[model samples]
Target chain A: MQPAVPLVARVVDLVKNYYLEEVVVRALRGITIDFAVGDFVALMGPSGSGKSTLLNLLGCLDRPSSGQYFLGDQDVSTMDDDELSDIRSRYIGFIFQSYNLLAQYTVVENIEVPLLYQGCRLDERTRERCLSLAEMVGLGDRLDHRPMQLSGGQQQRVAIARALVNDPHVILADEPTGNLDSRTSDEIMQLLTQLNRAGKTIIMVTHENDIAAWARRIVRMRDGHVESDVRNDRSTDRPAPAAHAAGLTASANSLWGGDPYRQPLGNDRP
Target chain B: MIPYLCLLLGFGLLWLVVPLAFSDKGRRSFVLALRSLWLHKLRSFLSVLGIIIGTGAVIILMGFGEGSMQDALEDIKRQGATNIMIRSVKASDESSTARQQRIAVYGLTWADYERMQTIPTVVRMVPMRILPLKVHHLERSVKGRVVATTADYAVVNKVQLAAGRFLSDEDDRYMANVAVLGAHVADRLFPFENALGKTVRLDKYFYLVVGVLADRMATSAVGGSSQTAEDFNDDVYIPMQTCRGRFGEKVVSRQSGSWNAEQVELSQVTLTITDMESVRPAGDVVKDLLERYHGTKADWAITIPLDRLEAAEREKERFVGLLFWIGFISLFVGGIGIMNIMLATVTERTREIGIRRALGAKRRDITMQFLIEAVVQTSLGGMVGLLVGMGVVFAGPWVSEHIFDMHRPAVLNVASIFYSVGVALLVGVAFGLYPAWRASRLDPIEALRHE
Candidate 1:
């Protein structure tokens, strides 16, 4: 009887340009895409391929020079900086590869930054929720450690915990595990994959093919244009190991009250 | 006392030394001015030094001036302007040191007294004659100046008789040898005893003491031959006719290696006016009359008590003005010092300003904070200056009397204190405003980014 809810994100004819002196450089040329709710999509591209630009646009850190971009039912291309910031705090969370955690804040305090920007008071309940987010990112034992005191992977985990603190509608990761070792990269990918399985929409930007393989869908771009958009069917049918699945299931239950590890393969809840 | 000093020092420290206390980015311009001032403390202090010295000088000088003026006024009140003084002088060219050969060039004669009585402005004229001699009373003999005057002398000069009665017209007509003892003369001649009604022998004549006169006050004028130390307390007053007949003006003068005698007319004449308004005009009229009677080379002097009173008042006003200006400078300097410190504080706290701006502080809020600080600094300085000024005023008399053997009147009044404090505050605010305004105009982002 009612029209089904539209996908979480949609872009049509998005064009981005940079002005130097009087000349305009086209960073992105008429890119169009759609992403369903709870879908985990990876964007792969070489340098200056517009992957970071798109992520910045979707995260509301920037606006396209020309085009329409809709996050759920709201048109983001027309929003002002203040409005974009508000939307970013309320609906979209970002995790940068460099782990941009404020050095002054401890792990828990970093996790509470989004809520603070959202004007949330640190009451007993909100503080407990921050602690729970820290636990979900495997930072429970390091809640009091400042970013400077933590190792690279640990700092990234704190950044991840901060990103998820506000419970936004979409998670945008720009090279989420690009700076980590192979072992830590797999661990971080597993964490991101587990988050996606629990109903969160994810858009990740990366240059590594191995990192892209972790996502269910991949979009390849070269020189400001999309080369291909493909579904990774082989990776989607294989589930994570049981012990790792159990741990991820526990973190999922803590994050969004769902057992993502026990879900049937190829479920694609969206 | 230490706590009060500590409080004062704390105020100085906050206003003068601290720089980080006033920063805010939203009020960057305001803060920048303050910072500039803070960076140059020495220059600021030097600039305000003139004001500091000026203020202190004004208060101290004015205070002393006012005190001296009050002293002069009190002296005038005691002298009674209704009375006039006439004295006899010798010719300036006279070279003879011999008393017998020296002539009384223009003495106050009996004819002058008679003529003065005819003037409409003259209420009463008392002729007085004096002769320096040794008087005896039993075994004790004292050298003193004896005077013979009419009964009205006591009334004309406002002299209070402590005992017995003054001479009457009958005593003058009969040439009675009745006398009044001055307070000092009485104490010296009859120590541990009363002199009233007692008989004393002057030269070869015996006189009975009728009364003892009260103490005479001191005068500040000097170098005038007019009655220098007229110790009314030491003088014995007799009837006019009795002094002329018994103790004649022809008296012996004894000096080192010289002995001479001379016969002179009246030594002094006192004129009284009926009203105070007529004193100046009457003095002028008498002077004209005396000039006509004597030649252009006349040797006589006239003193008008009223003119002296006016001079004293003028001196007081000038003194007060000078003191006020001096104090004003110091207060101004103090205000500038406060401004300098406040400016520095504004600069030091630029980041704080920015943060507060981001937290929603308005321009007015920053302005109020800096203004309040300036006001607080100046008010505190004013209060300290007041206390120090008061201490100096109060302690002046005590120190003078004890250590210096001098006495000075306390002149620090409530009005002066209030005025000084008010000026200090005004100076503080006026000088502090530019820095405060500069601080209040700072931009939040720029201020936060300030190194």
Candidate 2:
């Protein structure tokens, strides 16, 4: 229905099968999808729904067992491992749930990793770009800080800057705020919304309804297939910032240590 | 041979190094490896310890081996490669009647010395009469070999003079009782006073000391030849005529209830040929002449130092080869250590490999990174070992001379430096190949999932 928008990525009846201990798992069964430019799309599913597999395929982190995946008019489904890697480097940006920043590197250095793989010199222009990306993620003062030294929210911000440094065609975020307190999660969602408004395509995977509500379009997966596709009319109606302060204080206190999922949520109520 | 080897090594080093220095990705990988190594400084150092010890051992062992061989060769060289020595060894198969009568006459006689003078290649012949005698001075007495030879003996044997002059021909003609004191004898006989111008009694004959020889390293038995170990520092040199006049050919000693007399006119005849080419032929002539005259006695033992020198040279080649293999084996073991550490590093950094692969690093890039790390480690260890080995080589002689009171020369084979460093690089590449390949072949998704 969005014929006016240019398609950044399109998947046609894509299938991905995994062999685990002699059992062939149909992780993705003929899933068809299209992500348009500047679209904030959320892929939602329970565990074993193949939503993660679909995200992996869309990110070019894997090849489909069947069908074609077109990333900006190039069919990447049949590409080899090295070509897939190149596609990931040039066209796809991945934001992992664990904020997989290199432990040895500082903020600016981590953000410069993708460009380093692109064979770009760490010259004055490249350094300036990395510094600007760091500033964009609101970590201007922490440019020299390593991931271990930073709090969880700051580490995730570094990861976000790393994903944006290459100016990729699409940003694939898998559970962007899964480990954060609801307040920090909202803050991260706000950053994603701002990035989406600035003409960047974003595909995020989340199980929480509130996180999915932030996306303009929602694609739900079940049993290795897309169960439903819907558009949220009230996408602009964001949750109040201070509505969950009491629960936020409890989760924030233990965010540095202990299991994050066990912490109380700020907006469990309707 | 060494230059060609060095050239080949240079090309090989360039082959590995050019890409890393020129390519941005390669340079970044190098920096990353350096950072990773720096982070685990102690572990990296421990990992390379085997290489350090192995490389250092190669240089030091080869250096010492070369040095000692050179020293032995120098000793032979001092004896003159063109010289043939015929010493009188008592024949074991003397007649039973001669032994029962206590008169043994078996050795090179004065006639044999005179006959050897007929050899065409004989440039100079110094006949020596060696007498086992006891010398006494004041409260000191020492058993010493009294060498009665011409003044040519000093130059022929490279004897250094500490003080005074050697025995002149006039002293030999006049049969003067003037002698040259060996360093050991002089030190013992005249511990408090200068040996020159002093009198030391040898078997009841007081001989005036005309000279004192400086201490020199004694030549040991070489090439398992019949040449007996001679300590020149323990000898007392006297004139030939004076020795004959004082102690005649017939030396009668009164033992416990027995009288023994041994008749030996000349103890040794050292012949110097015109050049190295004539030494072997001259030696053959001497042997044949002695064999013809002595018949079944065969009392003379001919020792050509040139033969010993050649044998020693051949032995040195084999020794150096053996040392090379020892060094090779150690370096090989060191290489294995590097391989082991690299494999563990590949396993430990699986996640990093995944991250890099996700960022579009090619398999070759991963291989290059790990290979560079291995080479960097070995190269660093090799350089340090080289410096250490050279230090030991340079300092070894001085330490032995000062602390142990012994002379030990250490000649650094300059080629060993290049060999050690080159072999270190080879070891790195050889041993690092497997781990690097394994790392490059790792699946990115599987690696990312690793803890």
Candidate 3:
């Protein structure tokens, strides 16, 4: 039988070393990992567990000292800075802990930034797509609002819309709800859960167990190595099956072709 | 007309080239830069003020230089480039009211005039005896200079006739009491009727006005010329023989109830050369002849307008060079101001740089954004300065003339606008590069962590 989902990203024996004031510190020591298409992963670790370093390598922000990293069959570990930037723009989406939206740009302008780097003009087609993306993220009314004017959750929504603007292969979130209250964090998590269920791949880093419970798979790291990897079939914190379905279904099918991960198994949306 | 056309062409080329040179990405970056600059409107305006002052100073200084240089050249040109002038000056040791004679017998003699006429290179010579006197015509009087000259005076001095005729050689040979009134003199003495055929009195003599000279622009005193500024409009001309017979050599004036008497045979002799090339040598010969006759007293001076013109031409080059360096130093300091502000901006926007990098902006992209921002500021400043400078250049002379009662001309140099703008752009690029390069080389990981 063909594998249920093809691998989207693979890292083999990835090693990273950092020098702090003349002392060598091993941030990531020969770690191996694979992420399948449309997979939702929660990478959990305490401080100094090398989680941020691994995330940087996975997002193509940094290259490993000695290892192989493949994103959709392209060897990206040995790529130069410019080539890495190109790869990141095309295949990786980043969600920072602090919601790094350019303070000067309007919400719509922030979303249009990735397309700007791709040499796209602000023509009608791109403008319409940017509008639709903003609307899909529930920021339809705040298109011209700057980051400072919006609340924390709205700003994150703008960041998410920006991340999805280029239709990247995998979305990397670093402590996506680290700065929010529990209620706001739950709301942000539900938004992520809906995006993942709609055939998007997401890898989030967090130290909170409850935040990790929202993901279908959890990978825990300690001392620069994966300590445990588990599938969460009974994560009670998951949202209702039908919540946010109506608004997302139309954009999901039209934008991403009706869930490539579940279509091969002949499974229909619940 | 050609300068205006060239200015129009320069603007046309700039309008066409700027849009075509930028790609879509570059346009986007340019727009982003403009938005960022707009965010701090006051800071941007202040940062650009130095450039405005610098560029305006350059154009204003060059304009004044060109204007004054043209003024001096025009004065020299009217003196006739091929003409040399010899003027009689009183010897310093001889007093006008001498202890024994009460008459200062000095200056150029009639024999010197006879000697000069024999020179082969002397194409034409006009000798004149100028006496400061008052003229009266029917109850109205005006103080003026009476010029006793030969018939060649009108042609040699470029004095054209406005009415009737100038003095003829017969007028001098027969000692006719006929005179030519200068434009202003005619207007003042007659006022209600034509001065031609009318009689005007100079001291004890009455002369018939044969002609009136046309109005001409006055010539100011320039280098190497001993006379004060002359307005030819205030002079009256008469035949040399008539003046010698009627006025004699003694000129007496009463000042504060004291009698001042001076005897000068010839006040001035202007010699025109055959061509420009022979003017200097002929001047030397005239000086040598005068020296031989006068011995060591040194009572006469020679002025060659051609020599003064050449010296002025050389001085212009040095003046322009000095002006350019002053402009360059101001622009350099203005560029430093731009650099200082841009460096602060780059440091403040470090996290923004990281965000852009993560979103796939190349190093060149960051550099281009900051560089474009700096260039936009200076270009705006340059344009404002250009308009203001041109305005001041065109209106400066008129303002000074009215307010200060001084005629200071300012000629517009069209090329200065283009030069200032190009230099402003160059300054933007030069000073903005370090900050831009610093921004581009920022480590993305660390930048994201910055506050």
Candidate 4:
């Protein structure tokens, strides 16, 4: 088969720095990476290894000090803050380890934030889509719960639903399961893995070896440099059952239905 | 007690409504100020106490000043402006002093009267002679000042006839003993009945009352002169010719084995000028004539009615200035109070300002918001003060006249009210600007971090 997905993002020699009282701290030092559409990749690094810095560069949250970052063919490294925010809102979805949901908003309202920022009217159809997204995340009954009222796992799930609300091209998750217990982490990892198999590109940053294993490919960083970029050969073994991954596949079909591999197989759940 | 309570309740209502109506920022700052005040109720009440006392002081003091001015003006108006009065004084001369050791000698004779008539500005001069005598009507007997003058006396002095006719030139020429009664004299002599056509005894002579003169509006006096144009009310008027023929200028008063007697000439000549504008010139002409003819120092005095009226007017303006400054000080203090409170509010709402800026509010909008708050506080205070001031102005006379036994009329001056309110609003903006500018210049990041 042709390589299953085309290149969706490219970064070349991306460098970022911060100034604190005349001292320059280099957060990202000449990092380079390419991410294909529909690919699930995890960035792995120890503390101060620049994994989060690289993710921020990729998501357009911060600009490079002197380097090039491109989404598809657009060079975003030179864009101003407002322009970068616009590009981020339009093309990238973020899920933080802390599940940064606004405390004042309900679960459904939090999920609706990206749409509201997009100037999209909260009409019946848009509201119905929000409800469906909530249902898809298994939060259909807890749509009105505030962030303070929800458990850590449920809040993370709400953040995930919010990330998907804009139907962005790439999902950038930073330590997505770092704050969860093992069972909840497993559940979240399985959900992310199913999304990747259905052709939604996901780039995650994590220090955990087991969490990095959930991705089909991993990029390792040390001292602000990418040390290795390699595919995980073991991901092909004991893949999740078709029935267990049907919801993810269905959502992915709706998101990117033209792809042939996302079609229903004979053993798929009805 | 009930009316007093009602007044207090009305004042309370005014305190509530006036400030709100005049405040520029609508209900937002009002609500905020109210909330802040409620948060620290004792401090708020203490702050407002300053304003209350200040407003009350302005009202009461200004009210009394206004009352005094009105009384002074009324008293000035009562003295006719067109009448030029000339009075006689005792001349210090050795011969006259020795001849009148027991007599009064300062007076105008027929020669002085002829010289006064020669002045071109004099319209009409009425010569007056007085003799202190005991007059009786029926059972009523009272010591009175009797005057002998020409028919022109009534016209020159602006006296009105209440009944019957005044003495005519025919009466003076024929030496008729017909008299015109003064109002008080009529009241005293007739008591319950009309004094017209009644006979009154004056020093062994009987005179019939032809008319009663209207009550005098004001008392007349010259500066440092012992002579006053006596209230015509107590006088029994007769023609000068009749008085000279019937009761001579020499009169004798005997008491306690001592007798005093003297022959005096005309006591005064009251000249009427054609217009108020000519009163000054006419007075100068009469003074020059008296000086040239009398040839003696301290023999005569002249009074200018127009000059007195002008002096009264100047006094009124000074009184208004004093009152305005008193009111202005309180308004200034109130404005400072607003500024102090607004600066505190700006410090307290720093976080709110950051949120608004983050949400895209402009610097001008932030400036306007705080300025509006300051204006609201001061304007409200101004309006309350104004209403209270006016209330005192209107009710002052009523309370004074009825309860305090003072006959004062409260006058509400619109100019003062306008001036006070305008100054108040200006003070509001003047004091409010610095704090509002500080609020507008606040940095969003720092403001967001402020508690």
Candidate 5:
């Protein structure tokens, strides 16, 4: 018997809608996606394609209007606000496109926010952890600097560190570089790739092609459903694929069959 | 004692619950509250200005109100808290006003004095015969009211002999013609020499001066409608028996070309009571006894110091309560102003609220943050206002003396300061509730989407 590896997050036929008094706008018709424990998946689509809605549901920022959503089999779609807050604080980290660091707080303080919500006092240990996270994001000397004092790249770096502060299993990034220049955008993408290479599961929402190209697999949404899913093995640098993902050695490689990113290897399915 | 324990227990409960509201998330909110308040200094001060004026006005007004009430009681108190006065009022039935111009005798007699002595609550009796007489010493003649009573008069009236001795009871028994001059009377009668052994003539009789009274603040005639008026400084005190023997009861008066004569046996009788509680009842008994003897209505009136003291206290309590509500209304209005500004603040910081929510702050944390900010504003206002109110109280009497030329006494009541500050805190929390609650209920997703 093989030991089970818990999935980071899984969703089955998720649907969401917005009501306008007399009109019901279907934001998400039906969507099914799963993120493995160490998968790096980018959700890509055009505007009005419900990619943001999917990211929101995945981030635990909102409940699915209808669907079975499991955060490691906990079925978070049925959870209430407080439970969602706990899950968001404990199980997942979020990075916004706008780099929403609290302006009044210093860089280190901003990074400590999620830890605080997790009921961690800002004692000596917490301070040390915050310093290391800031250093990890290459802001070791800017710990005491406010968000307004730093440049766009520095602020996003602070957000990245904030998202990873609690050691959450999965990170949800919503257009992490939407407000940055192309050069700064490439730097943020490199940081995300480095994190994913270290075995962190990263789920990102983006409309940019090059940004999506950094991910090992891409899921594209259109009109609230997955229009296509593809695996890009040649676009960027990542640690060579894992044995379980490459399917070159084991007869048990059929585990990749149900993967939305399995299209490129369908010739080996029989 | 039981009530005190209950109060202590209630305080302990408050101490416990207030801190629990500030859990792990609460400290961050507090820091946020402080930062946000500092971000807008002018608006915070302006918002709290109303509370300052309202609270300061209430505290200062209440202090003066209480001081004046105490002032009135002390005025009555100096007359003697345990003493009751019975005075003779001229009857209205006198077309027989000395019909024939013979001296008319009507009022408290020796029999009234004798009946007062028989009452059980009467601790001591001081009888007096007052006559307006002109006294001549050396080269000056001053007209003054002279009172004739015994040694116990000094004890009953709270008077101190400045020099020499008051008239002893022995002097009353043997009809010695020794006298005590009052402060004003002494200043007039013997301005050149000490009046201690001088002989002052009243008509054809001469009395040796034995004592002079200390200069004391003049007790203005009480205006309570039920009390009679008296001025004691311009009087000379003599032995009662000597007054009857020499001046007699009939006094002839010739003022401004009017010559008429009136006769009074005992002008007034003051009785001291041993127990304060028995005054009103003892007064009732004295009234019944006097009315039975006089056979007339309103012929005599009684004045009980204890009764007036209680009435003054009751009036002061009611006045303080009225002032309290006036203060509360202004603070209440100030609280409304706080709510209005806080609501605006909530709307303005909607994006900040969203960002905090996205950072994983709970509804409880958001509520505490805004509530603490409101608390900070009002409490700062409250403390500064307390100091300002005290400053006003300190300047009160001086301002009165320089501007209105009327004396206004004010006291700094510590209780009032505490009450004002406590009310400010209470009103801050109460008024901050709805805004905080509203801020907390904003949807996280929608809030983040807020432009």
Candidate 6:
């Protein structure tokens, strides 16, 4: 990995307010954070805790009511919708929890959308790049299939391919593994881990601790405030038994991370 | 599938031409719009329904109207666009003294024809004397109108000769006992054998048939002219001198057991002007000359085809205006339909818009996508309308002749097709503006949160 990477995104005292009729709802309240290149960070918060709000602002999907957002050298806090779109297309890619793939397009088409918006010619070279990205996401054989035809996990992989196709500066994932079962989620997490290992800057939003633990660094939020930011040294804390299971691999955590698995999050629900 | 593909190709060309900073990116917006419409096939089709009908109706109705107008104009035009006719009225509505005269004569004379020729704009003048005379051809006898005129009569009246030849200058100069039989006259007098070269008896004289006329639609007397609406088919045409020599100026009529001789010289005088600009001047000159000669008799009336042509054009313009309004209303309704559908579509696809916005689509991109969808629908509708309109135009004449028995030919004007399609597209884009603006105004966050 490259050393002393530059900051990919930085937010200073960000605030976002929502107007519902005559009432006002404050989604994000004076939050400050910074992310560096090659950093795989997970954002953890409950519903209405403003993690989604911060993700939206970082994705350039919305402007903060106050304070500044800088994606690299560009100040995005005061930009208009068109300028924001330019920033997003240039520097950001998003992976949604529901896998927001357009129904009319096939897996290849969905993956090509961001590139298309970047004014990239969908020539033979562009098509090859798109196919290669699909292959990386393990969707090489499903290029012709539509989102509806694929299972939930496969749909998520297609979304992953889409996000990576543009080769953006950073990937913003809102609940990357929220809708998947344990086995599929592990597979997806492994793919993400490989991408991160390849030095991708991933800022993922998830309420699950186990998913958050997959990240090298974790940022926990509560009521629009950062509760804690810490590094998780899972290799030193966990047992090393069955690290090599000779050719048998049932899950991503087992095959990729050399571990069985743990249900360390969602136990606090209800 | 082809229509959808055609929509894409058309949009692709447009995308390249639009003033966007990034044209290829703009094309992606069109792709998204095309896919969205594909999602709701029925709705998109319904939205364009009004436009199709509007275009079809405008083309079809305009076709029939223009065709019939031209047909009437042609009919009047066949009378010669620059020709003006002056006919004798006979002064029939007068008191007892003139009616009881031995030879009541109130009409154009040979002297008037001579004077009419001297008018500045009068290029040619033809005068004719006609009377219903008993004609005999062997065993067949028919009462046919005998017209005595110069050779210029056939050219001025659009008379076509079937066989043999028309009256030459020599025939008129010599007062030759030769006649040209009209279509119906020949058909009646000599049904099987050819009428040309057949000797026909006119009044008390036997005349050789020099020519036979082809069948033609007889014209009606126009604009208060005293000329009667007579079918020239059952008439015998002879040289000017021949009738004057054989039958003289007096024809003895035996009606209701009473016999009387009415001396009539010239029945009608047709004058051709130099050009269209000379028609009114020529008509005025002829009227002035006749009024000076006949005094207070009111014995002549005039018909100018150029004046009729202008009147017909005015009437057609009014009819076209009416059609235009009706067509415009239909297109307006179609526009409204598109507006309503686009508004609903914007609302329905709010989440998708949010997703696209998040994926880096600018407000202008969103606006263009929606606008292009509306245009595609309308253009497709316009094409369908043009197709249907053409089909109706071709089939209209047949249906009119067979079922309605009204011989109206629907003529398609090339410009109308372009105009209708262009207007339909314009209306669609106009109506689409509101919805596109609405979609573009959507806040990305709020839209994403709109379920």
lDDT of each: 0.71, 0.84, 0.84, 0.72, 0.80, 0.80
Which scores higher on DockQ, 2 or 6?
Answer: 6
- Model 1 chain B weakest lDDT span, ten residues long: B20-29
- How big is the RMSD of model 6? 8.1
Better of 4 and 6 by DockQ: 6
lDDT at A208 for candidate 5?
90
lDDT of 4 at B183: 81
Model 2, C-alpha of A3: deviation from truth (Å)? 7.4
Docking class of 4: incorrect
For B40-125, candidate 1 gives per-residue lDDT tens digits of 55664454454444444544555666776667667655666787887766557444534445632346777877888877887788
Ranking of models by DockQ:
6, 3, 5, 2, 4, 1
Q: What is the DockQ of each candidate?
A: 0.04, 0.39, 0.46, 0.05, 0.42, 0.47
User: Which segments of candidate 6 are over 4 A away from where they belong?
Assistant: A1-5, A235-270, B1-22, B29-42, B90-107, B119-123, B132-143, B162-165, B186-211, B220-230, B245-264, B273-298, B399-406
lDDT of 3: 0.84
Which pairs in model 3 have colliding backbones?
A: none
lDDT of 6 by residue, A1-270 (tens): 232667888899999899899999988889988898878899998889899999998998888999998787568788876777876665688899888887768999888877666656667766876787777677889889989999999999998888876666789999989899988998787777666656678999999988888887899999889999987777235332243221212221122232112111123212
Write the number of the candidate with greater lDDT, choosing between 1 and 4.
4
Positional deviation of residue B86's Cα in model 2 after best superposition, in angstroms: 3.7
TM per prediction: 0.54, 0.79, 0.78, 0.58, 0.87, 0.83
Task: Report the C-alpha lDDT of model 2 over B1-451, residue by residue, as the tens digit.
Answer: 5577678888999999897788777777777777887998998888878788888998998888789888888878878888899988877776574678678898998888889988988988888989888888877898998999998887678789999998888988899999999999999999888988889999988999999999987788877877878899889999999888888887777779888788888889899999998898888889999999999887889999989888888887788678778878888888888999999999999998988887767788789889998988888888888889999999998999999999888999888888889988888888888999999999877887789
Write the residue-wise lDDT of candidate 5 on A86-174 in tens digits: 67776678888888888889998899888787766667766876787787677999989999999999999999989877777689999
Model 4 RMSD in angstroms: 12.4
| Candidate number with greatest TM-score | 5
